[model samples]
Target: MACMQLLLLLCLLVSLCNCYRMFGRFSRIPPEPQSDSAVQDQWFEQKLDHFRGADTRVWKQRFYVNDSFTHSDGPVFLMIGGEGSANPAWMTHGTWITFAEKMGALCLLLEHRFYGKSHPTKDLSVDNLRYLSSRQALADLAHFQTVMTEKLGLGKRKWIVFGGSYPGCLAAWYRLKFPHLAHAAVASSAPVQAKLNFSEYLDVVQSSLARNDSDCPNKFKVASATLIQLLNFVENYEKITSDFRLCQPLEINTKMDRAFFLDTIAEYIMDVVQYNNDNREFEGVKTTNITIQVVCGIMANESWGSPYDRYVEVIRTILKATGEKCIEASYKKYVEEMRSSCWEGPAASGGRQWMYQTCTEFGYFQSSDSSSQPFSGFPLSYHVQQCTDIYGNEFNLAMITGAIQQTVENYGGLNIESSRIVFPNGLIDPWHALGINTSLGTDIVAIPMQDAAHCADMYPARPEEPFVLPAVRKLVYELLTKWLQL
Candidate 1:
């Protein structure tokens, strides 16, 4: 009896840990801690293998419900959870919940499997991870929808799906794969086509910065060239290590070292630009309410110096703004940690799960181009090599290329002929280049929100938000209304 009780307590603790991870994904502003009982609200339990045999292994799936505005025969607003743990915050906040309330519709936020508390297997080994595909996830949703509706006796209620970012891709794909489950979808920043080379990402970053200050892009370009040239010499490399305050000396001999070093800098720049909101804080950083203009202003204040000197000064300024201590950059640390074996590492399951998805289906590797771009160190080959390192020799360039082609063929890519799926992306979001930016069919529409960041329309209405974001939300509502009418 004692052993059984202890086991049950351990299970309960793991369940609580799942709830905590929901806050882990978005650490910009700390959310209030909820008790286990509070976390239990509206959560459901379902079998792990919705497609496979009757193994009867059950896991709890976290979700939030709002029936206050829902009529017995009203529409169902289903917001699909993304890569991380699903939080009730989305159900309570966000435009989707508000829109559901306006339409007197049932609002439900379903967490994805292998995320939140919905773990399928006891371990996340590569072999076990075979069940963690998007196809399997969608199947889980189909089962969940069927079971939930039957349990609630919600018959013939039209269901409209909603998602943002990677979940936005899931939302659109779910509608395409399972038309019987969802009437329509609202995909914000959804990258429909999967590709191995995504050089256009940096192009947008350059453009976003140029829009802030035309000189900014040129300055960045010059700095990049200087860094690339310095990597050629041992003494210059040592100087760079000292100047940048890197915790680990970059092994220039190793090809991955060079690629990882440059990729890290590019990622930092992308984050600041991607979350370019003056009202909100960037995730896990001291940087609060920043824009590209602010970054340029910091660079502009410095005296004109050698390319190498200018590069060091600009990086230091940017790092300080983003809450880094500047005592250590740790290029090797960043690369080794990221490229560490996901099978037996301290990295979270959510990250590993996403990496697996990228390895198998979406090879959206953002590499530097032949042009004078800031991240000139990274080539398309680096990303291809990363896939091989992560998943093994089987996932080579040929395999990845085949997967990308298969994805485009299977899902219709950006040219999908699906209807009633309103695709919206921000002009400022780098991911917009991969997303649908034009209408494919009469019912399908793509609205580009001006002066907006990633998934800008998905957030709750804020006073400081750009005018175009709220307008996009209104358009989404209008689209939803039209879809339901049919």
Candidate 2:
């Protein structure tokens, strides 16, 4: 009887321990340290600083969690915004932060380094910028996942990574890099390719132009010819002199230089390609005629001013702080390197490190790199391609091309097992989604909005508003949810 009683007690103890372990793994996060279980109205926003390096290279982060949030049943969704955008902005946006909070999930935002308040360096050179690459950004996500899990002490909690555009690329890359860390990832309008091809972009633009007027085939043909002429003019001028002269054309009233024209064209191309055409009445819509006029105006000038003056100013400020000359001779040298045929350093045996150096060197001066070779076959005549603006300074077309190409090649692949990629285009937008062609197979779905221009999400009546395509959202949500199941 004594032996039997001892055996029973041991069995009971084992079962109790197992139950405790299981409970610990699957339990909800406990209440805040300072709050009682009854406190329903309290909210918490915690600021955190972490060092990825030893020499005080710290990254600033913030977390917003509402104590009053009653729904703890879903996964924790983390949102990362695109390049040049900060975390706070997205946190307040309708699609991101608002969505997470309403869905009853823990919402987290990560601001990339060297952008916004997450400056990780006193010297933000191309070399140091390596940490800001897609790889490093994904690593940052993985690290945060570990930290969140440990801090919350919830073993069964699921994690979802969500982003669009550039951040969407990060989201997809994160899922691939740290498959075990995140349960699922949602990438919308993400360009997975590291490089930019003007040819692919031209095709999209031509298609959009044709959609505007099927009978206006000649207009697109003319546009294509003009674009090529401009590209050749710029390339030739850059090959000859460090400085050129600009002459005002009869068409445009704006006083501009070569840099201005090139930058403007690049920006215009990017905009038209991603235009949201479904709702033409949106306040942000610009007519195709205006876009064409703007392009022509820039190219007509001998040397226009620099495009993206603000970006140049930022670079100047950084350079000034380091007691370096605002315009270094090396800056021009790097620009020349971008235009050279041997730009990527003999492509056959090159690795990502070479690409990193090329990116960083170019990033310093707001100049272009030699990464655009892949899309060199792109016909520039489709858009107004100009060499020198009104001010006589030449724009680095080769470098810009290279960078786009590099971006496409590096991050362009998709995971067939997990999710499907989609490129939604607008019919009137010159820079249509068709510009990028990925090697990730035909799993990508392209949906062209008839009248939209750049950023279809902001269309007057988005599909998400009235839930016009709840099925699409359902598909995305289900895929992410399944991926996140821990």
Candidate 3:
């Protein structure tokens, strides 16, 4: 659900911060598309339903291409966009573009159907969203590939795919499902295995923070314990709300609201740790790289007062950074925003669409079910309820489990047997838990990278980045070159 302007506007609209998973996967602030002569924006007439022969509905899917460094017979490098709108800059920049330049490959960035300006549906109604799934998206890629083959005179040209996060899953799955259509794939920080309750996400977060030589885990445990103890008392709600500087009175009438409150609070550290430090830039005045070290530093500062006081500061710090007016912890408001069937406004962040995907296809519900996690108030039940509230009563726990199971079965989960595919996973990224971690001979392989978080390798190589990235990225290039024969 988190893949955004790529993410800033989406985050501001969806969670008033980093847009959950995918947005962070792409960016926190959406960078404007820099005008480049080599980059050309284009649209393709994509099928609304790939399976239904009778369904003749079609929509214009947006995509971009960059031919700056491409030779006539160079390989094709397609960078698939996930939940976020495909940034045209992706055609001109990013690690994929770097590879394209090196390999004399043409770069293409394809926007997902429901995201960005690609309107497969006029609205976000449940009935209309039936067509939104990974299967259909993969089909979209196939259709695009066929079109590109004819349009660009790429009849015998080999195609290699690049994707991060949800798009990463697509890249790997695309190679698996359409082996004839693709030559290879590079999936970065991708969670291929479908899960109903992603408690490991939290576990990974805890491990990420603790492994960073930061006292954040201990500080969070004390802070969360104190807050949880206080929140249990109905009388302390008012003081807690006022102290936290919430936009509205804390909602505790139902258990869902309570869970939402914890979810909102936990997201502060969750997003920070998830993103960590990655070399992402936009034409903004500035952007704060909120890493785990920054958060751990905050938690360890005794000058901030008690652990609870430090926790409050963390929220304030994040709010100020993201330019949000106040802490929005109201569960009803979140539901109200998500329930809107309109295509514009806040829901346009692809939040509703991604939320629907979570409900129907990939159940990436980051739940606080494990007591091992500091953020423990929010349970898996809240995730189910959130889905039900946005969609309908039909999206219950049973339905969610079935949907997740179906996705896992469809893709063969982590056991996907595909050749010429590279899984570059960052140990720090929680999503890496679901991605493959071993090599299958010389073709299908996983490159486990330490200190890399989210899609760190997808970004252009930076001198200041973790030392392991350069080596891992080189290994990926060696594998890719061996396979692509470029």
Candidate 4:
């Protein structure tokens, strides 16, 4: 009876699996049609849907063409999103999308693979995830170009790719990889080099604290000290423990916990930076409460309690825009791995393994860019060497730097001049955008946005109007137009 019951359960599970596979195969949204007659019609706005690749994975795509279309006017504008996002929510709802609609040109938003409704594979490992690389992403845009020209029968219509941040990097790469495909490309806040160095970002935080002088120094100091202490505890676990027993949860004062404190400082800084750079005392007293809420929310949630949590959150926001859910399960699994392996062995016996395993919980630390030699041009390796030399192997600075550098380099390189790529950065960015001082004969366009944090664009309330707004937009737009023409 027991054997029969098990066989029935197995059969049911197989049936359910088969049903899911079949459902996924037919779930894709179909591309809209473009009327050939409308190609010459300037007042015809239409959306298109079609399958481009041979693979059965027929991912859905949307094309918003203006009311008027003429092959004589040349290439249509294609918007690419940054980082793990499919499309910018702001663009879809804000002035950008409206501008595209008014321009009377085809505005194509291509969702990146593995994001939104475009899951390209069943497995999401580091190996299979290689498809998520910049090269493959560029290929997606190229495929769209072919579709627009050949399948859609839109004769001689050029494409102009535009994006900011990650998409900005993509725009530059698209121009480089497929020069003939696009007539023009515009990238904003483009990050072209790969590597992560937090020292400069740390310095930014310190400077901000000094400038504010708003009791935030205490919080910053506490957080920094806690991080160092945590590193020390992990490094000396074997020395302190006899048989590698799990230690009791370290009781931390909620008000003083480093993570909470850091979040508070970051929130205040971002609030100030995002709004018009008003150093005026924040009117709301809830800033501290909000910071505590953010910190506690991340820590209490099993999925968000890791060092790379910030990056993961950002990635999630981007992916969510495209209707993708890739990280939730992975995050849970990571937490389980850490919980199960804590203090399982001596520092020398299993410390490295434990650290690597737990570190993987943070998605931002994973990068494919590395060199066998110590001093290669790779910024990730350089930062890793610096960290390991100072703090030792207990904390894998290599992993952190490797992840940061790869993402930046893969998505951020902008070749403005024949001999140089300028990387303009605000002083207060935590991403350490200033850490990369030089790369591949590229000129660094490092602009220090006074009292700015993260991306300079985040500071909308800069005192200087002409220097901030028009300058940024014109520089990015002109660079893309010129690069595409070249």
Candidate 5:
């Protein structure tokens, strides 16, 4: 039951990333919440559109630079921010900062073009969101590199790009696109492959649960089976409503409401699993490290309650932790909230921006259609429906498929052609479903961190963390040193 707070932190923590969209803010949103008293804010004048030369539109992109440990002609380590505010703490902290000190490199963390304080558009309107894409973000990195080199009077210093999660994709892609600008890349938990039917997301989640406690998956499976039964029977509808303690009575007959109710439960569990233990905290909420293990133990304890009841307890407890009176089970309200154009609620925290990105480009929708997975309420169709509703009718399944095809073709997807890039994926991280988890070539290497969660390797090695993380960090440093020829 203590794990409830951690799950609450998962959805409500704006500094991180999850809101029924993807990743726990899917761990892309709020960066690790650190005190910014020592951090200085810096901004870069960037072109909104890099593709069109005629468009002179520009935006002030936020960034932080740490040259405390620098040398003339030393390498520059640029940590790319993903789908959230760029924290200056990365420039000072993180495993990369250690490498920066060892190699006498200058550290920089650049905010994504439209995220955080970097507003490339006046509003997150559909028309303005067109400027936001991975391609454009990559171009921003390219231009930023040039700006830094000239602005700081650094002559031809080797630039190593670093990113985790989505930006991890950006780092690897940046290296591939502008090899001359970026000498090497460290893409941790980088999902390079653009997947539509990302049912494997839950596969990893279930596996992670089983890893903590083997019977935990069985509990969830049994619970899901019971839930399926409950949803199927009209007589059990009241029991379902009473058991979950919904604020609004669930429209049991409506397909959308049923999905909303079941998916809401599945989502809380999925969020906890996806970002199980990356050691990130936001606002006043705590990290999900110890809670994940605790939750697994609770899940398997039959003495506590039945499997379905325990499952409901997890959701109910989490909702209670979030300070909600009851479950907001209105699918219509949820859809309306997502469809809202203003930069409040989901829009303010980059969820809306990222949703638009997913709708237009990367459809990394995590559904529970896979038979091997424990949960089964949220399917690929649910995501497709949300996308169509939030964006427009043009954002249909066929269009999304074509867009993903174009993205994969453009970036090479799983078969990305690149060199001097290290893709470090967590063994338990569900997002690694679309990441390159194997060695591609002599230069493009994949390091799988066992018992690790998303971007675990990116953080600085600590004694209490898993042994693989420290080893992975050491390897990343050695790779950077070798690649930079330091």
Candidate 6:
């Protein structure tokens, strides 16, 4: 389940691009717990609107810089921040620090606009969210890089952009959109495609679990069948809701409520499978070496109890694994909050900001369309309804569909043809299916880490690190070095 925690973390960072919405599933509110602050806090005055004319409003953009490993003539490693608060711990403990030190490079971590302390407006209203986009954020990176270079007196130093998950997508696109700005780019687990009804995501989850234990997928299928049967009967709904300790009884009026219930289970499984990191605790929860295998074994054991009972136990187990217990399970409550939540005034609204992105640009909703898919109850309609509730008349299937098509056409969609970028994805990462998994050009490379989890290569190295990660990092360094030489 450690991998799930990593997935949750990745969602906070990567979901801003596509992949999945961080708080869209269940009541998994509150951003993943961050590590201790290690880097100095600093802010840059940035323009409110990068493209639109005559918007002179300036906002404080949060960033952190580390020049300890830099040399006057060495390269600069820019760690692109994603959809969450910019944690300085990355500066001290992330793999970029190690790579930067190895290359004697300066490291700078810049938070994306509307995320963390980098707010361009007072709130996350629709008007404010109009300015929150990849285009503007990419512009922010370019402008910030130029300013930092001048401020630090680094003249024409080679700049290497580095990021994992969503920022990773940005890193690769920066090279494509602003080719001259980045010498090379390392985009680890970057999901470049903006998809609607991203059922392929669940496919990766199923495949990863089955790879660990072949019987695991069958066991999961049985559990899902049991839940589907149980939930289909209105009489069983109240009992099942109580079993899951839902704050309220499950509603039978709409398919959305049932799908929400099933998604809690689906989200838990997806979270653990993608983030299955063995060596360390994640977000203060204990993570096993083979979490999916262990959970599958437990769920498959018939001697313990009935399949439905065992499934219930598995749900409880997953909740406990994340250091959380029974939560409010009302889909209606979620919709009500989504509609009434204030994105204005003070406080950082990460979830609201990202939801707007999903509504506008990338409808990467993780819904299931097949019986083989675990969360089969969550059809694409559930996602559309959620979007409608959030954005009112401004959001709909037609509008979201248009945005998806435009995003794909403009950025190469699933077929990103950018060069001078190294795209590394873990086979187990569900988001890998949405990214560029094969090289389409001479300078564009895609390396799949066989047993690695989401963005495993981007984290700080550990004694228990997978063998392929170091190999991939070495390749990334070689690529960057080769690019610099040219």
lDDT of each: 0.71, 0.39, 0.79, 0.38, 0.78, 0.74
Per-residue alpha-carbon lDDT of candidate 5 for residues 209-287, written as tens digits (9 for 90 to 100): 8886888887989998899888887778778878877655557657767776777767777767766666654322343
How many residue pairs clash per model?
A: 1, 74, 6, 29, 8, 6
lDDT for each residue of candidate 3 in 292-357, tens digit (9 for 90 to 100): 887778888999999998988887777677666667777776776677666754655677888888
- lDDT digits (tens) for residues 251-313 of candidate 2: 221222333344333332333333322333322222323332333233233353333222233
Q: Could you tell which candidate, 2 or 6, scores higher by lDDT? A: 6
| Candidate 6 residue pairs that clash | 2-275, 3-275, 3-276, 4-271, 4-272, 124-343
| Candidate numbers sorted by lDDT from highest down | 3, 5, 6, 1, 2, 4
Q: After best superposition, candidate 2 residue 398: deviation in angstroms?
A: 12
TM-score each candidate: 0.85, 0.52, 0.92, 0.49, 0.90, 0.90
The parts of candidate 5 lying over 4 Å away from their true place are 1-25, 31-35, 232-248, 282-285, 290-292, 316-329
Model 6 earns a TM-score of 0.90
Supply the global lDDT for candidate 4.
Answer: 0.38
Q: What is the lDDT of residue 316 in candidate 5?
A: 68
Model 2: how far is 31 from its true place, Å? 38
lDDT of 1 by residue, 1-486 (tens): 543454444343232222222121111222222334323446677677767676777777777777878997679988887676566656556788788778889988888877655666665656777777777777777878999999999999999999887888888988998898899999988888888788888888888888867888777777777788888888877777777766456567688877777766556566667767633321222554556777666556556475556657656766666545433233334333334333323233355566667778888777886473555888889878876776678979898888778888888888886778989988988889889998887778899989988888887677888888777888889989888888
Which pairs clash in the backbone of model 1? Answer: 247-330
Q: What 10-residue stretch in candidate 5 is worst by lDDT?
A: 13-22
Model 1 CA lDDT for position 470 = 70
> Could you tell me which 10 consecutive residues in candidate 2 have the lowest summed lDDT?
21-30
Best by TM-score: 3
- Which sections of candidate 4 miss by over 4 Å? 1-75, 83-104, 152-154, 196-198, 208-219, 222-334, 337-427, 432-467, 474-486
Q: For model 4, how does the per-residue alpha-carbon lDDT over 1-486 read when each residue is reduced to its tens digit?
A: 543454344343232211111111101111111234432211111112113344444444433344233334544777774333232333233223443444445555665554433445443333334445556667777876786667557676657676544555667667766767766554444445442332233334444444534434344344334444543445543422211111222223322232322232233323332222322112211121222224323323446444334323433333343232221211112222222211221111122221332232212221113221101112334324323332346446556545554544444433333221233344444333422323444222344344443334422223543255446544544443444354
Residue-wise lDDT of candidate 6 within 1-486, one digit each (tens)? 543453344334321211123354311223443655556779898888879668788889988888889898789998887777776767776667787888899888898998777878765566667898888989999989888778889899999899887788889889888888888899988888988878888877888888757767767777787888887788997788777766556786777877777876667678777776633343232544447766787777888687667767776776565445455566665554444334331123466677777778778788888555555678888888888877687689999999888888878876776678888988877888888888877789989898887888877677777778889888887887788888
After TM-score superposition, the amount by which residue 217's alpha carbon in candidate 5 deviates from its true location, in angstroms, is 1.0
